[model samples]
Target: MKKEASAKTWNTLRNITLVIILFIFIRYLFDEDPFNDRIGWSVLILFWTFKGLFDAVEDKRSGNKKSMVANIVFVIAGLGILLWQGIQFFLYK
Candidate 1:
C-alpha cells in the first residue's frame, strides 16, 4: 500500500536524522569544552528525545509494534543518559 510505504520512508528518515544528531553530539562532546558546549548538548538531547517520541507515535499509528517498542526504549535510554550526565555535572563538578 502507498500509505504503508510512505510510513516506512518517514520512519527511515527519522532514524537517519536521529543517527546524524547523535553522531554530531558525540563528536562535540569529545572536541569541545563541556562548560561551553552544555547548551548545544542540551538542545541536541532535547531534539533527540522529542524525535524519538514522534517516531514512536508514528510507529504506533502505522501499527508497527516492534518499532514502537524500540522507539520507546531509545527514548528512555536517551533520557536516562541525559539525567545521569546532568547530575554528574551539577553535583560532582
Candidate 2:
C-alpha cells in the first residue's frame, strides 16, 4: 500500500512538471524570430519533451486510471499549446 501511494505521488509530480515544461516551451516558441531565439526555444523543447516523455512513462508504471487521464489531458493540451504557438508565429512570419 505504501509503495502504491508513493507511485501515485511520483506520477502526480511528473504530471505537474510536464505542465510547467509545456508552458515554458510555448512561451519560447512564440518568438518573432525563431532563428534569433533558437536558444530559448531549444531549451523549451528539450525540457518539455523530456519531462513530457518522462511523465508518460511514469503514468504507465503507476497504472492509476484517474491519474492517467489527467496526465493525458495535460500532455495533449501542452502539445496543443506548443503547436498553436508555433503555427501562430509561422503564419505571421
Candidate 3:
C-alpha cells in the first residue's frame, strides 16, 4: 500500500512537470531569442529524462510491463531530443 502511494505521488509530480515543460517549450517557440533560454530548456529536459527513468523503475518494481516499456521509450526519446538540441545550440552559438 505504501509503495503504491509513493508511486502515485511520483506519477503526479512527473505529469505536472511534463505540463510545465510543454508550456515553456511553446513559449520558447514564440520568443525572439530562443538560444537565450537554452539553459532553462536543458534543465527541463534533464528533469524530464530523469523523471521518466525513475517512473520506469517504479513500473518495473510494480510489474507493470506495458508502462515500464512506455517509460523507457519516453526516456530514450527525451534524451535523443535533448542531445539534438544541445548539438544545435552548440553548433550555432
Candidate 2: which stretches are off by over 4 Å? Answer: 1-46
Cα miss at 15, model 3 (Å)? 14
Better of 2 and 3 by lDDT: 3
Model 2 Cα RMSD, 1 decimal: 7.1
Deviation from native of the Cα of residue 46 in model 1, angstroms: 2.0
Per residue, candidate 2 scores C-alpha lDDT tens digits across 14-84 of 77876786676666767676564654665575565556557666667768667666666776766776777
**What C-alpha lDDT, on a 0 to 100 scale, does residue 32 get in candidate 2?**
79
Segments in model 1 whose C-alpha atoms lie over 4 Å from true places: 1-34
Candidate 1 pairs with clashing backbones: none
Alpha carbon deviation, residue 49, candidate 1 (Å): 1.4
lDDT of 3: 0.81
Give the 10-residue window scoring lowest on summed lDDT in candidate 2: 34-43
TM-score of each prediction:
0.59, 0.48, 0.61
